[model samples]
Target: MTNTHAAAADGAEPPQGPPAPNHESGTGGAGGKTNPAEGRVPTTHPHPKTHRTPDGLDAHLVVNRTTFRLDIKLTAAPGDVVALLGPNGAGKTTALRALAGLVPLTAGHLRLDGAELDRTPPESRPVGVVFQDYLLFPHLTALDNIAFGPRCQGATKAASRAQAAEWLARMGLTEHATAKPRHLSGGQSQRVALARALATSPRLLLLDEPLAALDARTRLEVRAQLRRHLAEFEAVAVLVTHDPLDAMVLADRLVVIEDGRAVQEGTPSDIARHPRTDYIAQLVGLNLYKGHADGHTVRLDIGPAITTTEILSGPAFVAFPPSAVTLFRDPPTGSSARNHWRCEVAGLETHGDQIRADLTGELPLAADLTTVAAAELDLHPGAPVWATVKATQTHAYPA
Candidate 1:
């Protein structure tokens, strides 16, 4: 939008632009921190399971307007956490809204458990949602907050409060049941939000950045707790998150959407091992290469071929973690690894204890080395280095 074309026209390739998620700056940490909870109450969720839905959580999502269009499909089963991962403006939320019945489907079918839900209104659809902000009522106690859903579903006031108590106890918020939303902590509020949604017992559960509001310390705890809850859920649960780590840990499978289209969909490990797009490649912090594998070696279209432990017969992918690459200040006269490349350090950034160096050469790649190694090589933004990767370190799978 800022005339990025001008830079490309001037002999420079366009930038990758801002990272998919900048939530770390405000509340979420740099891949390590998360957002603080915003207060709110909500309804049903899903769990993680190895089983697949034979019929799937069928959806042919279609929403059209003068400004944009959405056409996509998502199918999963009960107990499978399907993460919708993408950058902003990728229509991830739009597709979720369509399935939730908040946005009308211009033309498509939304079926869950063999029932037609697309034609139904949001309230009529037994779907639960945990929004980015945990919109809890400031005046209500956490117990009442969790119980609000059941009361709306026709339970008596006393029974609802009782059910809310049970849920609060499960979330480890029994002591804070009487506390108002303002009196609660971010992590507690998130649990309350999740509790409220699950109280409704929805056949389909939706979460949008569930842990995006927590800090680093709280994120670790909440992530583990959320994983437990998802494991407990027995219905269809779909979560939309920008963080790759969250998607991998919270969801059973991933459905990546970009520009309102389904770019890729597979198990988190599957997608991580064989990334088709640069976005997915960067998210997993891996050097991905598409190549042909035959017998003992895999060949890339680029400068060097990669050898792997597993021998494949056809098209395959060779991937290695950034840390697996070793950098040198000069071309090594002798090296143990067969795969080596000379590259210019295009950029460098600190990721926790190590620094990730983005290199430019025969092929753009990111390599991670410890601070000691980095200092030894005197790595800098424009320094040249020789990188070597051991054959045993490379992982190859069918492309």
Candidate 2:
């Protein structure tokens, strides 16, 4: 990756031409003023003054459609990789498109490096986008695909190809450089997309479900490679993904969106340790309950009261993993666990090597037990069982 960066910096000189006027606002181009002598894209916009912003990328997009409305705020530093994580139709892609200037914002601002870019066209914005499908040109070889960006930026064909070759080597795809997109593997194609985006020297990079097209094994390999590249990126990067592990592993911070709004934004550890919404909780693999808290107990709205170690008042939330729950065919005669619920097994399924029992009765919860224990208890749907959890196993926090 370092080699790729060095090669891009060394191979193609910056764009050289008469500074194109910023056509959108009848003002000079922002952050992309061209210099004929140096052939470099200005790091800062013209009207906004030449100064770096505290935030590399700052946006508050509001788009209203007939059926869906998207409103989300995003901020990141120059070296930060922020992931927009949510379930399908959560507007992750819409937000990415808005940032890339592909979608119009009905309201709010878009700024990069202290320059306002709300009106900039997609081609004029100092942004690069890698779409979910890789979107490689089928007729273009991997080398030509990577060189496409530099060529658009006014690099000579030879210079662009040289830069592309360097990036191909860095991505370990030099051998496949001459192969067209259709001939490349999913992982290789993904790398080509990434190289093409980076070759533009964008100050703001957007990737939408960058690995969604790959198979499981290919995804694992591509994810690691993408993470390394993202870390080495000098500017702000925003990636949209529904995969919890991808968001946690690849991003410096996470912005969880639901129904077009940001529900939570924090470091991965912060979100994993304390999920605020049921969607987030489930995504992180924890059972979440909302209820009212009095002292060390929470009375769930679902009719179950959970005992926890934290003392709290008013509305609260309690979460515990399925593994924290224990199941018994009969109520234990002498159990120290303070939280117990009588439940009937609604269903059972294999979760890894353990059997996950979904229960419904006094309290609805999921319990995970070893297959051996499940067999010993003869656990099956419609069977009655007692679920127990020590109060210490649950975490309670203010709602």
Candidate 3:
């Protein structure tokens, strides 16, 4: 099932929450202590002109077919990396195709390096794309595949191969230059694909699920390598993926798509801290509350008092990660944190070394604890538990 809904092509800020970036490796955990990029999110407000296009690549896209449609707006700076993140049917791929001119635009404008390209053909658009499968020709050697693009652009054959050799060496594929695509491992093939794309000298690069085909063990190593390559490339790069960890790790900003619309967009840390949709909430594992802020507290529907450092005076959001919530089989005393509720454990899920308990109480919330902690509490789906969270840890900000 493909999602053809319209999403925000224009980048914007996502809701705020506990610092998402500062979390550890893997998607997320209940009580992981370290974040790869600690404090990756900025706590300040955006400037009045914060939306200005970067490196002069401004794109507005609306693409439609009989069975699917996509609309989005985006602008990128010379070295900025933007990620389009969504579930399978979220229209991320359709949006990318629209920008590359692989699919015709029903409406909207695209400008790269100050030149309008909405009407340009794919070959003329100065854009490079790395497909999900690392679609190199099986018969062609890695060197030849890289040289293919340059040669097609009118460089002499020898010159093209020389340039190809240079790129292969740059990618640490020097020893594998003569190996055909069939002999290349997943990571090697990916590098060859990337090198080939870059050899075309695109001003904007589009990568679609660049690591989806690799085995689990390879994703981590390749991702780290990809991050370095993206950082070194002096141009805007937009990648599409569903993995929140990947977006947070590989990109400077994220555009979250749900059913075709960009429900939220921001830095990985921003989205992680404050997820706006139920989809995002589940993806990041947090209890998200939205309401008005006046004086010392934010009022919820079936409200509880939340104390916070932020004192915004109007509509706002309050959020906290599951690990911040403490659970007990029985109500416990001697705690300073103000918020608590008694609830039945609706469900229990085990992931890696931790257990996630979904609680149905006055306020429905999820709690993360170590397997040992869960065992210590003798937790089960039907068990009763008291849940608690500190007001100070519950982040609050203007909605």
lDDT of 2 at 98: 82
lDDT string, candidate 2, 178-262, tens digits: 9987788889888987876666677777777889889999999999998888877777888889999999999999999999999
Name the runs in model 3 displaced over 4 angstroms: 1-55, 65-68, 302-309
lDDT for predicted candidate 3 compared with the true structure: 0.71
Those runs of model 1 whose alpha carbons end farther than 4 Å from true positions after fitting are 1-56, 65-68, 292-315
Model 3 clash count equals 14
Q: What is candidate 1's lDDT per residue for 1-399, written digit by digit as tens?
A: 112243234332322321111111111112322212211123222223434445549898988988888888888877678999998888888887776666778998899889897666455566776766776656568887766555545555677677788778878899998998889989999999888777666677788888999999999999999998887777778889999999999999998887788888999988987787667887888888887888768888665678788889898878888988888888877788978888899999998898999999865688888888888888889998888888888888887
Q: Give the TM-score comparing model 3 with the true structure, all chains together.
A: 0.82
Name the lDDT value of residue 260 in candidate 1. 81
Which consecutive 10 residues in model 1 have the weakest lDDT in total?
19-28
| Reference-based TM-score, model 1 | 0.81
TM-scores of all candidate predictions against the true structure: 0.81, 0.86, 0.82
Candidate 1 lDDT for residue 234: 72
- Kindly list the per-residue Cα lDDT of model 3 for residues 45-161, writing each as its tens digit: 101112333545788877777877677888888778999999998899888777666577888888887888887655455667777776675666888776655544445567757
Number of the predicted model whose lDDT against the real structure is largest = 2
